[model samples]
Target: MWDKQVMKPVSEPANSPSYVQVRLKLLRDIATGVWPLGGRMTLSDLEARYGVSQSPVREALLRLEGDGVVVLHPHRGAVVPQVDAALLTQVYDIIGALQGMLARRAVDHLTRTHLRELEAHLARFDAALDGGDIVGAVAANGAFHGMLNSLGGNPQAKALIETRFALAQATRRLVGYSSGRTAEVKQQHQSLLAALILGDGEAAAQVLVAHADTARDDLIARLLSKGAASTAS
Candidate 1:
């Protein structure tokens, strides 16, 4: 049984592969700050942590490594990247451009169904933020973009966006989320949706790019603040 401090664990989908289940759980743990950046988890420790065997754990780490979230040592363990300013800037830069690309393409293919789905995601985001559920809000926010990205119908671009998810999660977990940004996020989403509805791909892309830049800037500020605080302490 998970300890009391732990939130209820995410249940794996039925018949999922063992390694995939391990990977999801591992990602969740890392994203939630169970391990600090640059922390090492040896093969045995990971096997124990997730209550799985070595085979699946190794495979899972390989996948995360490929996604640029972890580094593997020969015959040893994995380490979460000790992210720096340059790395953060580079990752968010790529993420922003890809999201803008997808948002623009998303406009050309919108249907009533897709719009409704996007609205539902927005509602979920508002509710989460209202309740001060930062984790929930973040999850909903990801779902919102993920749905919009899908509507773009470019699997390659969508796949590239996903590869950055773990690294993005790490930055958010480290710097923390801001309710202060709520209004801006909501407005951006609303404006992007309106642009998509109006079939203005360029407008939607611009809004998305701006939205991404705003997010990146906020995280950078928070990250610097945390470092300063730690030094003072």
Candidate 2:
């Protein structure tokens, strides 16, 4: 079920030329299951829901299709696809490796200011998790990674990482976490932060890989369990 609070309009950027704001809102909503698995919705419905115009709605949906979150049909509107474990495995594997590369390269370039920014984001993550706000935690987690990925100064890498991050956001909503699971994630972030502060790129990369692996395994378990329950019922 979609949280009503999440459906509210996201704060927008003042100078964004493109409809990136609309895209993000749509991505977050879909990722968080404002529209459930395999659910169908037309552009008009999305326009009304997000208070965006037709073109931006269309653009957002097309971008989501590229990310493997939603599919478009000629006469069937847009539908969220069934979760594919194998595909997600491949995506996570590539993401983990690329993320490791980004972190490894970022070590030499990261400044004290960058480290402080990361610490701030990590603090946000901790507070969000403590409050049991999954959406906020996810946003903060993404920001933490975004800061690190930015330190590498690789635009292409950042773009790829953000895309994969969007896809992963979808999974987080599907595979909702227990408090213990959330705690584990928080610990992983702490470990990554410690490694970064020590200038241990290898250790940071290793933590990033392990973090992705843990997420992959947990999400697969949850999706499989959900499928089984649906089948049995």
Each prediction's TM-score against the native?
A: 0.80, 0.77
Q: What is the TM-score (0 to 1) of candidate 1?
A: 0.80
Scored by lDDT, model 1 comes in at 0.78
Off by over 4 Å in 1: 1-29, 34-36, 48-53, 178-180
Q: What is the lDDT of residue 184 in candidate 1?
A: 84
lDDT of 1 by residue, 1-233 (tens): 11234311123356888998888777767766676678988998888888989999999889888888789998879898887767777777888898888778777667777788889999998898788777777778888887787767666676667657556766776676665677888899899889988999889889988888888777777788888999999
- RMSD (Cα, Å) for all candidates, in order, is 7.6, 7.3
lDDT of 2 by residue, 1-233 (tens): 11243221122356663457766676667656687766898887887887878777777778778877678876556997766689679778977988898889878776677788899999998898788787887788877887787676566776667766666776776667754678798889899989999999999999999998998888787778878989999
TM-score of model 2 vs. true structure:
0.77
